[model samples]
Target: MPLNLSQYLHLRSVPSFRTILAVSVLLRVGLILYSEWHDAHSVVKYTDIDYRVFSDAARFVLHPTEGNVAQGPLGKRLGLGDPYTRATYRYTPLLALLLTPNEWLHPSFGKYLFAACDILAGVLMHTLLTSAILPHADAHSASPARDTDKHYARPSTPPSASPAASPTRREQLAMLLAATHLLNPLVFTISTRGSSESVLALFVLLTLHAAVRARWAAAAALLGLATHWKIYPFVYGVACLGVIGGERGVAQGWRGLVGQLVNWRTVWFAVVSAGTFVLLGAGMYAIWGYPFLYESYLYHVHRLDHRHNFSPYFYAIYLAYPTHYVPSSEPSVWQRVLASPLASFGPQMALALGAGVLFGRRRRDLVFAWFVQTFVFVIFNKVCTSQYFLWYTLFLPLLIPQLSMTPRRALQLAGVWVGTQALWLSEAYKLEFLGQPVFFGLWVRGLIYLAGHAWVLAGIMESYEP
Candidate 1:
């Protein structure tokens, strides 16, 4: 039979995943090669700041002797000091170890590694969507129930309380979602520039996949490794706990409620997660020692760089910054407190915990809870960056398929987010690149951007099926 216009257009809109993956890989590899060529040839060379740090760190990891790094050409050029302190390498030694192979292959080999992980993450999400993990409503009951002993129990393929799209529809949606993630400018740029968000993304997706499959040990281990890799992921431990607590934990009575949380499973999950995190930390300490403690993890807590940031609190941090370095300070204690990195602690934790309680029970497969939690955490975070956006956006494709939002609404919200970013970036460029005294103006713009972010988040809340 001949295909109608709508069917043809729909088919065109959702291309084959294999084709999409191939194009994505080729584009990333081609971009890496072109970038290297341009950097080598052009007077104005483009380089990602962190890529060099990653490369240098990997080199230092291979030859860790202090005299060797200080004497070698690599050390002379990159100024390789303590691996953690050198080139601002604020990461676990694992990344340096992971990327050392790239040094043998090519300088840009790390970019290829990041890109491969990026595509693989999308592939994994698509695979899970098509599998029995995120089973549609027709395949299983949506409502939660209790076993004879009042233990929380539910059907194998249950989605949120709502009926899910048919399997065929979900497959198409999964394809489109995977393609969206692969082509998203934010995700694409990060991987192209050799950021490890893709690597982190793979662990995150794997943890969620394992949790959804009831493989508690695997989930906990992956989650632990992820948390060790990036401190922020530690917050998602709540969501993982929710998975172990109960898929739905029937809300019929106190017995079901007791079974939901106070159980062996939750304890085992916590123990394994904590154990894995401790082991990784101990290993890193043995290799890198005290400096690793300060640079990789501790530095983040007290870090304060108020020079051109997106947070509205930057102005406060800036004012407080001057008081610390001066021999004599006259600013009030309140001003000093504002300058401290801990200023945003209260709201960040409150909102994150609130999101966890709010979204824990209702999930689209397994991501809705963590997605909401991470979104709340990043927006309210003291230090927000482009890579921070990737934390939550990683799961967006999976969540979007289950959202009640239309394509048009999603596009509009996306425009709002982009427009706010553009507004902030324009001001940022003026202050940073043009040497303008628009600090106050930029702070106000940050406030506007914060409002824009909150507006977008509210829309997401409204559209969420749960």
Candidate 2:
């Protein structure tokens, strides 16, 4: 049927599909080439705040025994004595692991390596999504079975088995997922920079992909790797176990459910993940001793307590006290006011537990899990840096295509993403809007943008049906 043919053709004919793929690939290549060119032209300078920290960390990793403190020993190196450090400094040991190898090469060359990893990460993201969405090739036409009438005559095997394997239905879904991510400006910007987010995103994707494919052990191992890299992916593991347990209960029995939870595969995954954490922690301890590990990793968790407000809440508080409002060197009065109850340890744990109870049942419920995790993290976080957008960027693509909204709704959401980047980029470039203050100062603009983000998130939440 021509209509059927049209449907098939349209799948591949989507506008901007090829362009999106090409541009994403080309931009990454260009960035690397440009960075290399710039480095060759002059001595590379650490201009960005993260760059300085990374450079110093790289030096430490290179000569750990030297005991030479470029910044300071681990505990003192953190903002214990420095106010700016308290406000801005946060450390993830995984970042140091990534940077250490790059430090072996010249720092500039090492940047190139990091950039290359980002490019590879981008490509992997692209492939992962493509594998999700594209339709499978016609196996018969491409296989030896076509030439052998005997093999085809009686159907020698089940439909599931064949010499040629076409892409599965899930793979087509992945392709669409990839398309959304490719178009995401935040993903584009983050991938271009020398951040661990691209890799972090890749690992998340891999873990999810493995989980969805029912590769339980592989999923666990990927999740373990992801946890070692960032720590948030552990939440995904909780979601996965919930789903597996639920599915097993329905399909098998209570005994089966219990057995599935304590299955060899699950045990192996737990061991692998735990072993990884212990090994990494041990390595950190060896390098800087237990105190340094505690300060850098454990104490770093409390760093968020210092953040007063970004745009979202700041605007509301500002309007309430327009005359009395004065930004202080210490935490804002409003921050303390809102902080007292929520910032308490018991409440934070309860909040996390509540979110887990809410969305833990569906492993395949990507949208719910993403929304819950992102919302909780963003709303409660002490600091909401623009780069934090990277945390949810990978999940956004998969969630976006599932929305039932009109194209206009989609466009509006897209605009919000664009606006977010515009605000951040303006700050980054020190561009003033007719003497208007930056994002940190434009409290009203931040509130409006926050509302837009909330609207999209609400759509996601409403779509989740238990």
Candidate 3:
């Protein structure tokens, strides 16, 4: 039965939810207005350069070829070219199709769309965590738990244990996390710049929300849609399977893990995911042809951008680069080495799988395991970017209630992370803008940034309660 608005308003958590929603909405609205004013006054506008790239893609999608009166639509094609030709746009054609209206509509339309998705993601995150913790709210005692990382004591309340003069504990945690994502300046800045990663994030959040509710098929389809759009979401597929198996109380230990993987559902998940991705790609292929294929899928597989890269290996790759480079039919041995999972991606996969197996023992474990998996993924990615941080941060806040770190300790670690980034950015700035030859210096900074993140992640791991 559908509940009425009044009934919803009277629910225990509604007021807090409303507060979160209202504050977030107001903040976004204010940012939009501020963006307009800033664009009017400042050279560096709020909207990012990607907005222009998206607009160009929309233009191409709207008119795939520059139409001629005499030649019809088959003259020189204006569709998205290969990455080498249309270097500005290197993503799926579906994004261009989705944003086709932006060609005619205002540019802010895209920003509004991405921002809406970003806010929606926060709502889903809250919903997933709130639902997850509610059932077990009454199952635990309210005794304070000892923080193991340091010798500090923290109140470990039963999930939403009712208390005098306060809201339910779970609701507060959920609202806090929701607010964290909604008001985060990093996410806000990206969404304002009209990045589509938030759209991808919304679908991934939906996938998790569906899986937590024991809806396996929906989870697989949603995740598949997300993976087709971007490759990183595939890492969370194991968490979805774990949710299904752990919820149903399968066999114990490694046997349960194996049983989880060897089931009909797992097979169906694979089939559906592949079917969805292939169907989407096939549809786009039928329209855009191989340029779409190469730019969207193949390019990322062999991507080796040695410039403006954040990985520590950038210097090594730069030094190893051929003095006089030429495109070839076959991948060079060095290219193969970089592309190989054993060399670059093996550690990330292994860590993600280990985190899934160890921490993904139940539905409650999904969010934390997801955070860890993504943490490892970004840290180990060959082309880590600021946008990639959004992936892990999507789930990181969900673990705050479960984490036993003190405010001061968390801030200390955050400062360490920021200092490392500042160190790298200083060198990178000189090279990129000032045109200084600081490639080796930037490489040293990248290594420092990598180590700093690893240290911060270790601190986070130690602070996690489960």
* Clash number by candidate, in order: 0, 14, 0
* Model 3 clashing residue pairs (backbone): none
Task: Quote the lDDT for 177 in model 2.
Answer: 51
Each prediction's TM-score against the native? 0.85, 0.65, 0.83
Please give the lDDT score at residue 97 for candidate 1. Answer: 77
- Model 2 over residues 288-320: C-alpha lDDT tens digits? 454435444566454333222433444444343
Whole-model lDDT per candidate: 0.72, 0.51, 0.70
Candidate 1 vs candidate 3: which has greater lDDT? 1
TM-score leaderboard ranking: 1, 3, 2
Q: After aligning candidate 3 to the native by TM-score, how far in Å is the CA of 292 from where it should be?
A: 2.0
What is the Cα-based lDDT of residue 19 in candidate 1?
86
- TM-score, candidate 2, is 0.65
lDDT of 1 at 358: 48
* RMSD of each predicted structure: 6.8, 9.7, 6.4
Candidate 1: tens digits of C-alpha lDDT, residues 239-292? 666555667563446676456656788788888998999998876675566767
Which residues of candidate 1, in runs, are more than 4 Å off? 1-9, 67-82, 132-169, 248-259, 323-325, 362-365, 406-408
By lDDT, who's the top model here?
1
The true-versus-predicted C-alpha distance at residue 118 of model 1, in Å, is: 0.6
